[model samples]
Target: MSHPHGDSKRTVWYRTQFSSWMIAVGVVLAIALVVIAAINASYRTVSLVLLIAAAAFLVTGGIKVTVSAHGVTVASALVPFLRRTIPLDRIAHASARWTRPREIGGWGYRWKPGLSAVSLRQGDALWLELVRGTNFVITVDDAQTAADLVNRYLPGPGEGR
Candidate 1:
């Protein structure tokens, strides 16, 4: 099937496991447990709840990554609710980098010290550094494919470096 936003000449979509919504649910549950435990003055319960919260964060972080495509447009996906779009011309550079959990720091459409780290595991990414200095990154299942798309559409200076 063709994605609505993809170019006519190319149509292929790639979807990968970003993260389990269960982890978010788990955080909510753990927070509730902590509140309940605190109200009931149960130290053991509170401790257990905190542990669960940590586990949820870790598990969720591990699962979360990116979904990308080359010829296909990725307008509608798991994180579409929080996704942003940047024109190819505005992209400065894109590459795959190993980002640790604390590297990006925090979740959901964020930019920390390193770069715009999509909340996904280590994978190929298409990064767009805007001419205005701001940058955006999107995770993709295939690095070479994403790069090819950037080259085809954008085709600016310092490409294929």
Candidate 2:
């Protein structure tokens, strides 16, 4: 749904699909365990483990993405503690980039090895370079859409592509 205000400002929302994969794998394993349990009477322990694991996957796979007139928010099932918000005024520049998995290396949020290393995913990213020598970079799945949002709300100098 579109925001209530007529403002043209945009917000790009993003979240990783890894949790989905985990959930899928869990479901499959659970099914396999159930089948094996039916055939082997001694595999009750294995079946129980698989069932628990499957539940975990299903819970963690539910990631959510939401965008509003003000900013973007991403929520994940696997990482229940993760909550990130990028305000319009805090953003300096926004773009999308592709990087190798190993290059990104670390899990969850990551940055490249150089001074200007951006997010590793191919999603949208906003560069928030504050005045206090603090820079914050965030990535979202929809790059162009997110960029458009930033353009509408906070137009930087010469920022149209």
Candidate 3:
């Protein structure tokens, strides 16, 4: 879809094997909790908690990254309440790079000192260097296309538009 600001929205979803494993584990744990609760009524509360955790795991099973004039937004598909959007104007540069989870401290969402990343797996990622010095990275396929779109949205040297 196109944004009112004259920019088209581009979105990509990345689902890792780890996420599938996590969802499976969560489902199994929730089922086990239910069985335990059936044996003893006192475990019902714990079972409810497990169910919630499982739902969270399912909801956040994949990462959705969008690039538009509004900026680059990284968020969970089912849960959009918690998201990070870096305005195009604030980005100094954007590029596609190969990165690893260890470099960013581990998977999921990570933040360490000058770098923040949604490090889903060890592969191509969109690297954004913001104007303030910190960098944001997102592990997604076709990182080059996303980087190019972000660069296109960025204002040029003397063109205020």
Q: In lDDT terms, which candidate is top?
A: 3
Question: On residues 1-161, what C-alpha lDDT tens digit does candidate 2 reach at each position?
Answer: 35434645443334454434556677798888888889898997878777977765555455444445566555554555655655555555544444333444433344444323223343344444433445445444554555555545665577642
Candidate ranking under lDDT, highest first, comes to 3, 2, 1
Model 3 Cα lDDT, one tens digit per residue, 1-161: 24324423443323222366656766787788789889889988888777877775655556778887688888876577767898877898899989988987787777899999887678988999999899999888878878877888788889763
Q: List the residue pairs that clash in candidate 1.
A: 18-64, 64-120, 65-120, 92-129
Identify the candidate with maximal TM-score: 3
**Candidate 2's TM-score:** 0.47
Question: Each model's TM-score, in the order given?
Answer: 0.50, 0.47, 0.74
Candidate ranking under TM-score, highest first, comes to: 3, 1, 2
Candidate 2 residue pairs that clash? 10-149
User: Residue-wise lDDT of candidate 1 within 27-93, one digit each (tens)?
Assistant: 6767766667667775756667577565545353332222233222333243344334554455655
- Whole-model lDDT per candidate: 0.49, 0.52, 0.76
Query: Each model's RMSD to truth, in Å?
Result: 7.0, 7.1, 4.4
Write down the TM-score for model 3.
0.74
Q: Which stretch of 10 consecutive residues in model 2 shows the poorest summed lDDT?
A: 114-123
